[model samples]
Target: WDAAYERELQTFEDIGDTGEIWFGEESMVRIIRWLERHKVPLDSSVLDIGTGNGVLLVELAKSGYMNLTGIDYSPSAIQLSERVREKEGMSNIKLKVEDFLAPSAELSGFDICIDKGTLDAISLDPDDAVGKRKQYVRSLSSVLKPEGFFLITSCNWTKEELLSEFGEGFEILEELPTPKFCFGGRIGNSVTALVFQRKKAKPSILDKLD
Candidate 1:
């Protein structure tokens, strides 16, 4: 993916900040508007996993979201994201080079976790995709505050699949609308947006035993 991004950046340096905003601008707008409609606090602490060039973080910052952090596995991606941050004059945002599937100790207790096409990229890996995705979910759950929001945008999975994957650990809050483009009467959007809240910890039977 990094190599592909490098090639893409070479071709579209004028257009792309770092060749990672594959979801397009329309989807970004829709998700941001949906968050506003749902009354997500602008001051909420946010973590954008697989942040790419940090386009999502930039958009959130432009929308007045203060506590912003972005993480990417690729060092080059983080470098480009940092460039974007500097160019945009956004000082409050933090950019880190880290793997979301195994995040660092410093990433924890965030009020909102945003996964925009990150899981889709993981699913594209043919080797152990299911196991890896499960690991990703576990790692994400670890960093989020109890009952914090997990907003995900994916083109690879439907709303049903997302809910199924996260239902064990979260409560489904809502499914945001996706723009439809029809081909041969098959009606569906290329992407899906799902909002979920991390489930609060349940009391264990061992508590009574203790």
Candidate 2:
């Protein structure tokens, strides 16, 4: 991508309401709770696609996970993540500025894939919606090992919307919504969290081409 095009990606610099932005949303907390309940091995490798601000990955680090890799497209975000990692003295989590649809060689062979609002944002773009979803899903399928988990958290989409897009190829372990908070009698689902296990083994290059 050109410099002009790269400038358009939403980064931490572009984020408004700095005061409102926080890592510990209720849904994310719930996600952590669920993960704790499931309790995968500590040795498992994790991939964080579109890891915004690197907050979720940092949370994973705090949980004692060693093999965490993050990929995001924004250069500014990448720089910010590196700084945070360095400042936090984090040695295990590797962050890369990369398009989600384009898998870096370093990205493959992960046991867990976590996406926080990445696929939801891509689906909102009308022009590239279909193609982007397809490519992203394909790359995810390629990178994830069999029996891997793809955990997604989204505020914009309901559980049904996610199921509609990606039900057939994987098994949905959980489909739950964030708790509703009522102020003046208007309450809505604040977020939807879903985790799916990749059933098929990562396809070979020949399998992918065919």
Candidate maximizing TM-score:
1
* Cα-based TM-score, every candidate: 0.90, 0.79
Pairs in steric clash, model 1: none
**Per-residue error at 9 for model 2, in Å?**
14
In model 2, what lDDT does residue 131 have?
A: 92
Model 1 poorest ten-residue lDDT run: 8-17
Model 1, position 36, has a per-residue lDDT of: 88
| lDDT assessment of candidate 2 | 0.74
**Taking the tens digit of each residue's C-alpha lDDT, what string does model 1 give over 1-210?**
677655644544566445557578876787689778879899889999888878888899999899999998988677777777887899899999888888888899999998888899899889999999999989988999999988899999998888889978899988888788999989988889888999998879998688
Which regions of candidate 2 fall more than 4 Å away from where they truly are? Answer: 1-24, 181-188, 201-210
**Quick one: best lDDT, which candidate?**
1
Write one digit per residue (lDDT tens) for candidate 2, span 43-62.
78988887656667777788
Supply the TM-score for candidate 1: 0.90
